[model samples]
Target: MSENNKFKDFFKFGDFGNYFVRVFQKPDPNQKSNYNLRMMHGINKISIVVFLLAIIFWIVKRFI
Candidate 1:
């Protein structure tokens, strides 16, 4: 596969894209907003951050 195709294969699933999108992007104005929704998204962002840190730590521990 070409370099681009290989890179595309790595991200073939959109889970990673959705994760970053949900964390960094602003909420859609057209979508409904409420206290519970805000809290849910907030918690999701925190979990994503923690999960990423764990992955990084694992890689570092493995290398070291």
Candidate 2:
């Protein structure tokens, strides 16, 4: 849990918009691994994509 490792995880997870990579991430043994954790991450990733798309669509519809 060092600051350096946190920085690495950010890029390792694919910067920002590519959060879907969590679906393919291997569970870290050091932390508690379970279905709920993985499922939550997957759902969160999907939400992020959906939210971004909605924002883009809204902006396009409003201005163009």
Candidate 3:
């Protein structure tokens, strides 16, 4: 196999190697106290809320 094929095979599993996969991964308890992790969690929560609000707005706008 070529170098490209080897790299492809490493992540061939569906969604297994996707960029967002890591975002859904469980946080390590050991790192829970880290400031960076706390900040990341806050960001993730805000982003999710914003995304949901955007979807709701789009639906309402579409119907009305």
Candidate 4:
């Protein structure tokens, strides 16, 4: 598959439900290391943190 196709497939497969599954899946020692996986995990963590912070800020704004 071409690089562009692979990029599209990533989104198709990595939709929200699959994302959480991927995030919680156990690491395999035998599998070759993948840069994409690490990058996705980092993005997931950052997204979750940012979302939580936004919610907190919204709540505080409502109270004040």
Taken over the whole model, the C-alpha lDDT of each candidate is 0.86, 0.76, 0.76, 0.81
lDDT of 4 by residue, 1-64 (tens): 8999998877685477576676756778898879998888888878977887999999999999
Residue 23 alpha-carbon offset, candidate 3, angstroms? 10
Candidate 4, backbone clash total = 0
**Least accurate stretch of 10 residues (summed lDDT) in model 3?**
15-24
Tens digits of per-residue lDDT for model 2, 1-64: 9999998877674455354555556767898878988788878868877888999999999999
Per-residue accuracy of model 1 over 1-64 as CA lDDT, tens digit each: 6999999888776887867786668988998899998898899889888999999999999999
Model 1 lDDT at residue 20:
72
TM-score of each: 0.72, 0.53, 0.51, 0.52
Give stretches of model 2 more than 4 Å off. 1-30
Rank list by lDDT: 1, 4, 2, 3
Please, what are the lDDT tens digits per residue for candidate 3 over residues 1-64?
8999999988687764453556666766776367887788678767877998999999999999
lDDT head-to-head 1 vs 3, winner: 1
Q: Which is the leading candidate under lDDT? A: 1
Q: In candidate 4, which residue pairs clash?
A: none
User: Candidate 1, clashing residue pairs?
Assistant: none
The positional error of residue 33 in candidate 3, measured at the CA in angstroms, is 1.7
